[model samples]
Target chain A: MPAAVDVGELVERARRGQPRAIARLLSLVEDGHPQLREIAAALTPHTGHARVIGLTGPPGVGKSTSTSMLVSALRRAGRRVGVLAVDPSSPFSGGALLGDRIRMTEHAVDAGVFIRSMATRGHLGGLSVATPQALRVLDGAGFDDVLIETVGVGQSEIDIVRLADTTVLLLAPGMGDGVQAAKAGVLEVADVFVVNKADRDGADATVRELRQAVAFGHREAGGPPWRQPIVRTVASRGEGAGDVLRALDEHAEWLADSGESRRRRAARAVGEIEAIALHRLRGELAGVGGGRLTELAERVVDRAVDPFTAADELLTNLHTT
Target chain B: MPAAVDVGELVERARRGQPRAIARLLSLVEDGHPQLREIAAALTPHTGHARVIGLTGPPGVGKSTSTSMLVSALRRAGRRVGVLAVDPSSPFSGGALLGDRIRMTEHAVDAGVFIRSMATRGHLGGLSVATPQALRVLDGAGFDDVLIETVGVGQSEIDIVRLADTTVLLLAPGMGDGVQAAKAGVLEVADVFVVNKADRDGADATVRELRQAVAFGHREAGGPPWRQPIVRTVASRGEGAGDVLRALDEHAEWLADSGESRRRRAARAVGEIEAIALHRLRGELAGVGGGRLTELAERVVDRAVDPFTAADELLTNLHTT
Candidate 1:
């Protein structure tokens, strides 16, 4: 538990766009400090205003470079922006070059832009719990737009799709990333696709392949009918960033008209609440005498009872205890 | 709920190696039929004898081919084998192209072999619930070896490593798979690394890179000193299959000698029990009037209370109800 702090003052300062206060609040969330509940309470009113966007793709698809370009484009439109670069790998390794931070230094002096890199300290569900709270903090701080950047590799990274209102999957030419994305089930989560480094030799081919893949990757029969557009960009030279912005705007509008944004946010809330609830339940179960549970497990192993029955008995004992 | 099943008779037949009875038991588990509890109760005494192995790797890495060859080798060694090839993709998609089934035909008619393919139908944690129960059925049926095969592309697939006593991670040359494996954090989960397609060009390089990666991927300080072995196998020709088997035997010996096997199985039991318990809790939460949870969420959204506090209220209300 953390010492009692003036959460109200922190919230006020953050609401007034004080970067240090906002950073402190986010740190509290990331560290799972006891003040987090107070911070969440404070920030609740100012959330749901920012349009959260997720950017992900296979490694080396210039995800960071494209994210930087997206930031510039959003800032040009006079919208305050925040970026979260998520490293899906374990934090213990600690060699995260975070090369993207170098690319993002252009916005280092801008008060309207915030960038942070997040890593999981190998705790299960660590990223899932922290990322959303950080987003809320940024949203409460009045960032009109928040961009989440992550490497699209494993299951944990796939979680970013749930947090973002719109997910952009980036790929480059000649990487056979389209197939890899499908295998990873990432293709199904994409709201929009981008072929970065379009000036490269295989840009057109990549775009064509993505278009074809997206065709077969259609949602359910009665989905919004918003065709996932594939745009090509050369993020290095800042070309076609505006097109991505336009696509985002179009998706945002579709989300609004289709009433999907509310549903997505509601679903996200339900998932988070359930996860927290489950975590608490696990804690309660752990506090139960290990000998009792092991005895029941041994009974199940010895053919005296089924696992479901053992589980039922355990739960019953848990509640009574 | 299903009709009252003659669980005692079914168990007796399955114990006598009746394939139909075994199939019926597995089906009950997968479908969550009411008879499942009875079946589990009947089979509990016959469990914990079979050696469970997990085979996983990226796409195009000859995972299926290698699994097939491994099954053949085990059969020749007079071991009855069971395979569960899990497809993590949604069942609604209907494009699994599990073409590997064709390659497995060589053993299709072998009375000593059993193979089954499973899909999730997009239910979260569906595979987790079903896989273990099916393993129990096979184990109770007197199978000497059970091989669980899955495409290692997502987070859910990673759970397979926890379920198996020994996990074999397959890779091939020239795919930059070593680096990808490291990036995906698969290097850490591997107990045995197999370079499939050992005859391919760059096979030696892949093997060397894997050795280096495993050397560096040492487990936490003062943990088990088990060094992961890297083996090369050309599964198409059944080459090096014996070596892979030898490695598995070595790992099995190590697991038994160090008391790691019991600890692993106990941990696995605890995890499964917790997951099932959580699922029940989620169901209870869902059964709560949706409007109540939504109102609480709205209050959180409006900054009236933190989510934790709201969750606490919900749990209290649930207990009272």
Candidate 2:
């Protein structure tokens, strides 16, 4: 069993803007150790203070650069920001490489900005297992804004929309088409659509295609009330970053006015708690019966009997024993 | 509530090659209706008859073409084949378009060939809730071989390899150097690597790069007993299909001789059953409490409290009630 973690101390240290404590707390939660639950329960009240935004797209779409530019722009607007750049988990070690953090050295020394690279840590959904808890910590730590950058637009990636007030889908010029976007499942969730690397060829065509795609799918002629703005940005040069920020601000306002923001936040809270519960149940179940599950599984595989029946018997045993 | 299904009758109809019954059985398992447990129990005794293979790669890597060609080749070899092409779920209805089956229409008339397309169905791991159960049904129906063709390579795609007796990774020409192969999580899982679209530029380079990448990763000079053969093919033209089949045959022999085949199948069976159990439990939980779980989830988003604690409380209530 893992050692018990001190929830209060970790929260206090994180609130004081200690990066290491924040990282450690996130690690504890991502690992799904029993103690992380206590820490998350304590941190819940601290969330809802920071405006969280999500950035997602296919790999090699310049998501990291876009995030850096967005952070710089938010700082220019006089807001303290926290960034969580999530990398895909390693299949072998089930850990993340955290490679994207190497690209964001510009904000490391700025006290107004806190940047951290989180790995999925084998969470089924693309978000970090402890993301909601970590967001709460950042909220209590007094960050005015939080930006979550995901590696790809998998189902897990869509989970970001639930956690963020606004989600920006980043696309690169000369990449895929509207069908590809639909396939990635990004068009449905994005509040803002950005064609990054706008200086590249086909930028206008890609933007037009995205607009048409959105128009075709929108229920109303004027488009959904959120108005997913398609902005062109050369993130590498920080060009058009202001427009992205403006779009985000406008969307934030829309969210507040429509009262959907509060509802989404509540839904996100429930999802986070459910995720934690599932994680814990999986762990606890794996530990029961002195690992008899493995033996029974093998027996089922050996054709001694069927797995469904085996599982039923196990559940029955759990009930009676 | 969905209507209860008859497992034995459905299985018997599917065994007689009734497409509607097969489709209905698949839907029942996919939706996690309570009857799936009974259906799976009935089908378990009939599995272990099909030689399951997994095909996976990045988008536009010619996975569909390769799968089509492979099915054709297997048919020519006098084998009854079943193909399950896994596509992303439709966002609107959460159903698959079943496009792959349409693409392979030539095989539709052939009684020996059965093709089905499965959607991820909201599972984060990319496998549908009913995949394993569906595979079992197909197997029980007397398919000499079953091929699981995944549309994209994500974490969930890796799960396909664990389910198959032999796993093939398809790579398109000009998809970057062998480093791209390594980075895409294909290098570790593939038993056979195919440099598809041989007519395209960089086909030779891709093959050479893959050879070098495999060499660098292999600790032993002989290549880990199961050497990943790099086969070049223009799957559209059905070129090099013979060599691919021969390579598969050799790999199957190798696996059997080394006892890896039995071990892999056993592991796959356990995993399939566990996944089915988890799927069933999720559905059961979703159906309880008059959907209060979903409502509480909304409350969590509203910031009433943290999700971790809420989930635990919900699970506790579920267990007690």
Candidate 3:
């Protein structure tokens, strides 16, 4: 595809809000192509401004409905939005899954919204590397808001959630991870908690439990001063998405007042810089990296040296060569 | 603590099979102390010989009992054993959780059996970096077998499982992730599938479903020729642990003949080398690292330059300095 398609032209079109151009750019990111560095350099100047929101929770808690509701609400507010619905659990990837497309059909021709689902299928540095780069693409392409929705099951989900400026955790009445996910320390990253399926049987119980958990968490807290708000929603009927949006606005205000917005972005940038640099360094030090890896690996098996010393030797060679 | 004790002498004691010394050595690794490189250098020669077993699955599936069962079985065969029960699911680490301590009380008096639980509490590099080093400590200390047990909820567990030569995935009758976990592609990492709580009503059904999944998985497979064996165990009563032990020996023998063991260890070494080199390189490039981070981060945020260019400049400074 690169033999014919000019990456520079793609970037130009993507910046002008061409959905196909933006999709191609994301495909390149997901593919972990050799041209990624060039793409990133071209896209950088226009980035660093999108309001990244992370929406995550365990499986089957109406994440898609809530995401769609938020999308509709954001569109009504007249903001250009981009969503990367990522399923890190699946080891395979081709492109946007049918489920993602179906849930998002209403906005297919809106021109104000863009949605993409990332599959890990042979992603070079895994989702951690691909996600930040994709976020860059969306942020650069003139989107005012970017939403990252994940199936919130693993450490990768945790890492992706931290990339956002604000996180909203969704729960249903009888899901497995009501307080369980919070206990795993994901609660610290959540700015708002939504008990979706609020019209269901145990909605009140779920909300009450979540409120108690939130209060208990803050009782001995030492980090931020903003108390998290728990909102009840029946996203299928679009009941309380407005309240969720209002909560996001209020939280954004708190972030600015506390100087946490600047701190979060700075920390996020450092993390991105660190991941990219380490990935590139790994490449340069490993025959260019792979072939050299074989020789070094053989030597270690032969007890010629340990991994630490071999890594030192690899670094030494890098410094000299 | 370092000024009060000699690392060299401690290494000597640990290598002599002193449990306290081994515990202290692991503490240093868990703390990501500055002495890790020296410790690795010292432990390298005596390492490379222990059989590593990874035991993992979802929570409440009797991992502790299985680990304890395996410990007794290995000791009965006259092999010194080590167990590192890692809880990556927990954000707080205060050493061994009381539940972990309680589960293995039977082996507490056996000098030949050692068990430790890892909490993530401020682990400098996380379990991925710490597990291999901790494995080295046990292996170098003359333990013939080292077992890594994890709650198996996330990506961290998958990484830890790969560090071992053989991985045993335990599943109960009606746990959250039965075939669902298999679908997420943890099926490939598994060498033996143990359906614990075999006396439960759904045991036969789970085994039958797992067999079908395994057969389906291998239909188009091109890697190792080993068909994964499914073993059923009521771990709480120590009923089927012997069968699991026999399965381990069979797998070990197969690994010896298949050359997969050599390849797996070499790959493991390559990963460890990559991690260490990146850690050291990131340190050098970032200003001794953190202070340099703040200045570069500000520039990226101010749009003075993008993160890619900033990372490149950081690398350039690293080479020149």
Candidate 4:
């Protein structure tokens, strides 16, 4: 049964870029509402147009400031933007400070811009099954760009990279030790590196180091390489914002020319579908208490059955259900 | 289909606490070798014994130093210990700089201690499906304790916390800002907090801040609370090592008393089983590339079907398979 408010009407209004309708649908996603299936089905045809951009970096690295500035740049270009700032909540505690929202206040009144912060509170890693669906909602709502900003350089940020058309890694100067600490982790996900705070003392050195690290990392990976561009920025001063956009445009063009866009999107779709299906299967398995799964796990613990065979047996039963 | 080395023989030797045999079995886990299922099944009876401890902090908080000191203390009590230092490698570039190994070499000649660094290369997060299996191997091999050290505050470390019986969150005096940066991410996993470098000026301040934060986090989470004890240590000098061990023992007793141990282990088992099963399902789907799965994804992308329905159809086919 759908909500008392006709889901059909909401979909139509959301498609026309009505903020209220989009907000309502996203809340549905967040709540895991029963009628989300209907909403997702309704959002189908208008999807896949927005270029999803993921922005991530270590904590205290100005990810929020950069995101806000980028939203301004996109708006200046006459593009409607939707931002999802994913916050990783304290593991012991289920609260998110969300202080980053303060930097984005400039975009609060602009209808052309939509910004929301999502705390990865209950989810093991941030970006639950709801995340991709949320992106689809923004995509379907005629947003030209969807920017995802995840807090910290952890697993959630990496997962976010898989869904983005381009991933921007933000860094700042004089964070030499910090750069050294996270460079290896960030190298894997960065499509474009932004050394923000270029007005700081060691900006040139930081940029140079990053370039070298990127080159070295690419070589080690041993792929036919597309070199990740390192762009310097003073996001506080709004300098180098246009260059970042230009670099994104170039990457977009490259993706189109190589047909990598289609392949990447296809792969992303497959991943999302697999994740959802697995989640459902897990739910099904969990529903049966003191059931076959527990017995099998105990047997595996006791060495009565190999994990693979136990897995096979579980899967066989899964098929019948 | 087993390796020529006679897996059964190795399992017996490892059970007898032959360090070399244990090392060989752990290598099998790391490689994801074909005989892993056999190894896992064989090791099941010997497990449920070793207390797995996870040691993690931000990059430069001296996790290795703290781990080494902890190992020293554990060995002094005549407890056999195994250390799995998880290295988070770049996703794009399959490389890990395992500098942490050098610090633990002081224990190289000590027969009761085993230290190995596992690099998470080509795996999205460093702690792969292999990690739990590796711990099981060490567990089965009669190690009284297995200390797992991860490099940074990321998703892999969080996953590691799931497998650990007690997770030690390491901090240092001058790491105030760094601690603040990672506090929320680390809060969920910390069972005991160790403020290393106690000789430094801000040691007491860091300890004070952590207690306050821990209390705050607990209040916010609103659970049956376990008070995480803060211990100060100058790990390099081996000062306060005994206190750290006391805190761990207290936590261990608390876990057993509360029956949280069983719940945690059961939860861990459920997680491992689910991960393995999901891996198999993803493999099954990938094997049928450009097949029904892709079609379903395309349908979902086109809004021809909701993701849930598409997922259901996929699961149905998976069941039949």
Q: By lDDT, who's the top model here? A: 3
Poorest lDDT segment (10 consecutive residues) of candidate 4 chain A: A89-98
| DockQ winner | 4
How would the docking of model 1 be graded?
acceptable
Q: DockQ of each candidate's interface versus the true one? A: 0.33, 0.36, 0.37, 0.43
Per-residue alpha-carbon lDDT of model 3 for A227-299, expressed as tens digits? Answer: 8899999999999989999999998888788888888899888888887777778778764556666678778
TM-score of chain B of 1: 0.89
TM-score of 3: 0.86
True contacts kept of each: 0.27, 0.30, 0.42, 0.37
lDDT string for model 4 (B1-321, tens) is 645567789989998878899989988876767777777877877788999998877655667678888999999899999988673422111233446346667899988888776655544213547788889889988999998876445555577667889988888777533675556567767889988888889988888878788877653133255889898898889999999999999989888877787767766776677677767666665664438888987776655776778777886676665
lDDT of 2 by residue, A33-149 (tens): 667657766776676679999887755567778888898999998999988765342211222234634667788788888876554435433343567766776776778999887
Candidate 2, residues B217-309, lDDT tens digits: the string is 643133237778989899989998999999899988888787787777767766765654554455445655326677777766665756665
Chain B, TM-score, each prediction?
0.89, 0.85, 0.89, 0.86
Question: Model 2: what TM-score?
Answer: 0.86
Who is ahead in DockQ, 2 or 3?
Answer: 3
Q: What TM-score, computed on C-alpha atoms, does each candidate reach?
A: 0.85, 0.86, 0.86, 0.88
Candidate 1 has an interface RMSD (Å) of: 3.9
lDDT of 3 by residue, B89-130 (tens): 321123223354566788889999888777543566666677
* RMSD each, Å: 4.0, 4.2, 4.0, 4.0
Candidate 1 per-residue C-alpha lDDT over B1-321 given as tens digits, one digit per residue, 9 for 90 to 100 = 567788899888988888888888888888877676677777878889999998877655677778888999999999999887774422111223345346778887898998876654443446667788888999999999998876554455677567889988888887652236333555677789899888899999988877777777857334468899899999999999999999999999988887777767776676666666666767787787356788776666555766777778778866777
DockQ of 1: 0.33
- Candidate 1, residue A218: Cα displacement in angstroms equals 5.1
What lDDT score belongs to each candidate, Candidate 1 first? 0.75, 0.69, 0.77, 0.74
